[model samples]
Target: MDFGLTIDQKSFINEIAEFCSAHCKAIDINDLEKRGADPEAIEQKLAAKSWYGLPFPEEYGGSGRGYLSVGLLIERLAMGGYPYPGRLQITMLNGLNVLKNGSHAQKMDLLPKICRGERTMSISVTEPNAGSNIASLQTAATPKDDGWVINGQKLYSSGAVGERNIIMVAARTDFSVKAHKGLTLFLVPSTRPGLKFTRLEAMGRNIGGLYEVFFDDVWVPNENVLGEVNKGWSAMTKGFNVERAIVSAGYLGFSERIFNHTVTIANERYGRNGDSGKRGAVMSRLAEFATELQAAKLLTYQALRLADREKLSIEAVCQCKVYGSELAKRLGDFCAEVAGGIGYRMDSLAQWYYRETRIVTVGGGSSQIMRNVAAAQLGLK
Candidate 1:
């Protein structure tokens, strides 16, 4: 695969980097973790530049670039280790999925606002009962006169808080059908009655505001159904592929952050004993992390290219998520180890990195779930 960036892609990369360098200063992980804290100030700050919609269609107030450019933007944002840009990308991509499959009215109402960064969207898939087993999602959408009465609970949904609109969700639309069938995606306004959000406390990337959304007979219009009824299962899966690709890009950025911190600390920090000889062990670990980070980066880029081509099968995307997230965790651990006592201290960047890294293994989908996907794809069972 040709990894070389074209002139346009190169220019896009430069623009994103300049934005991050100029505006992303002084924002650290701790500042991002507070409940009900607003990332909107920084978000609006970036929206002024209009890079928020790089991957959506230009007709919908976007840049109209393809997935390759989108992936590049995500990668750069992740590498900055700042959260607002990543949140923007996640919201834009989720909104785009609705455009890809939702009714014309749905697209018209939502996509433009999302592209302009005036609104945000999120995917609500996980629940107390449904973590990796998406088929087991118990959120129910009962048929009603106007549209559907959605009543269920979702957990760990990122960007639910403070988003203008949300992708309200449900499952088992037809009880006769199997678990995976009849599940559907919906376009619900956060301001809608019966839809409530509770913020979830998490380790890293707190700016994303992971949430528990409850749809208590949340009334949605028939016009809001995304794609066909039973066919939502297929559409949601496709959206997940997109989500995983974006996540892999973020992991790549996070890996770079930890790896850089590890090296910087190793080179400059004295050993707890104040001996320069401690530098030798630190450098050795840094070299090892660098090597692993390179391996994970190459795999992630490969996945990005495949996703750009629309060739990312479930198995391939899962593989990318597994390696990239795990690599991030390993890098974080290495940073903490290299920093010794300082790394373990609260509010230190390395401690934050360590906390954030653990979540990567569990979020998106657990590493075990990815392996299960790969095995099923390979017919190993």
Candidate 2:
């Protein structure tokens, strides 16, 4: 895979970095968590700039820049220090799913709205019982007179309901076939009757926190079924690869922030003793972190390339997810230790890094799952 980016791509990435640092500076996650706030102001700013359409097709009211640009935008946002594109990421990715699989009318109706940020989208996959094992999801959608009534619950949905927001839910339409075989994806309005959302308190990255969604007899017509019935799992798996790649990119950006913060603190502490950060041991460790971060970026970019081509290699994705998340975790740990008590403060960047980094290894296919995937792809017994 080519590591060099086009001049336009490079410039776009720099532009995104500047925009995120400037626009996302005021987005306080604590405030969002407390108030259950949605980042609508930031959302509107991105919309006006047409960034919400950066990667979709021109026919869908987008810039047609492709998925690589989207990944870069996310990476820059995270490195810009706040990394609060929680809803944006979810919307763009699930929008891609709709673009890829929805009917002609569904695409015409929803895709343009998605690009314009008039209709945000996300998934509700994790259940009280199912985490990484998506195959066992028990949400049921029974067909009734040309429509379906969904009845079940989901956990860790990204955002709360909005008048213009839609959520993709996976439900078993045919329980006769076991596991992933009988599931279908449906797009339902967050404001639809019988649908509910309750916020789930979380550690950090709490841009409104995760949510618990309840569906009681929520109904969607045949037009709302995403992809072919029973083919939902295929579309979902494809989107999972995209999500893992983007997440790895985010981790790469955050790893950069952690490294910069740690080094600055170390330099100041060492200089206080007149060593002027001339500590060779400290420098060596920092160098190691920088090297690892670069490697993670490479893996993430490679995965993004596969995502663009729509020919994702699961093994390659596992490599990106595993290495990038683990690298971020390591950098966060190292930074917290280097900064000592200064890092432990509630308001400190070090503490924030430590908290944010904790979730990397747990979401979107944990490190253990990634290793298992890699092993299977490698033909290991």
Candidates' C-alpha lDDT: 0.76, 0.83
For model 1, the run of ten residues with the poorest summed lDDT: 163-172
TM-score of each: 0.92, 0.93
Best by lDDT: 2
Distance from true location, Cα of 183 in model 2, Å: 0.4
Best by TM-score: 2
What value of lDDT does candidate 1 attain over all alpha carbons? Answer: 0.76
Model 2 per-residue lDDT tens digits across residues 1-381: 346899999898888878877887787755666666677788888888887787788998999876678888878877775554467777887888887788999999998998888989878999989999999999999998798999999998887577888899999888899788999999999888999888877776566457899999998898899998987789798677777887788788888878888889888876557464456667889989888877888888888888889877898889989998999899989889888889888777788788878988988889998898899888997
Off by over 4 Å in 2: 1-3, 272-280
Tell me how far candidate 2 lies from the true structure as C-alpha RMSD in angstroms: 2.2
Model 2 residue 292 lDDT score: 86
Q: Give the TM-score of candidate 1.
A: 0.92
lDDT (tens digit, per residue) of candidate 1 on 1-381:
345668988888788788778767667556667653546666787667776767777777887777667777777876775663256766766776776787778777777777677887777888898887888888888889979888889988777766365764655587678888868877777777897888877666566677889889888888878888867788877677767877787888878877877777876785555576877777777777777777776777777677778887887788779988898888888888878898889878888888878888887789998898889998898
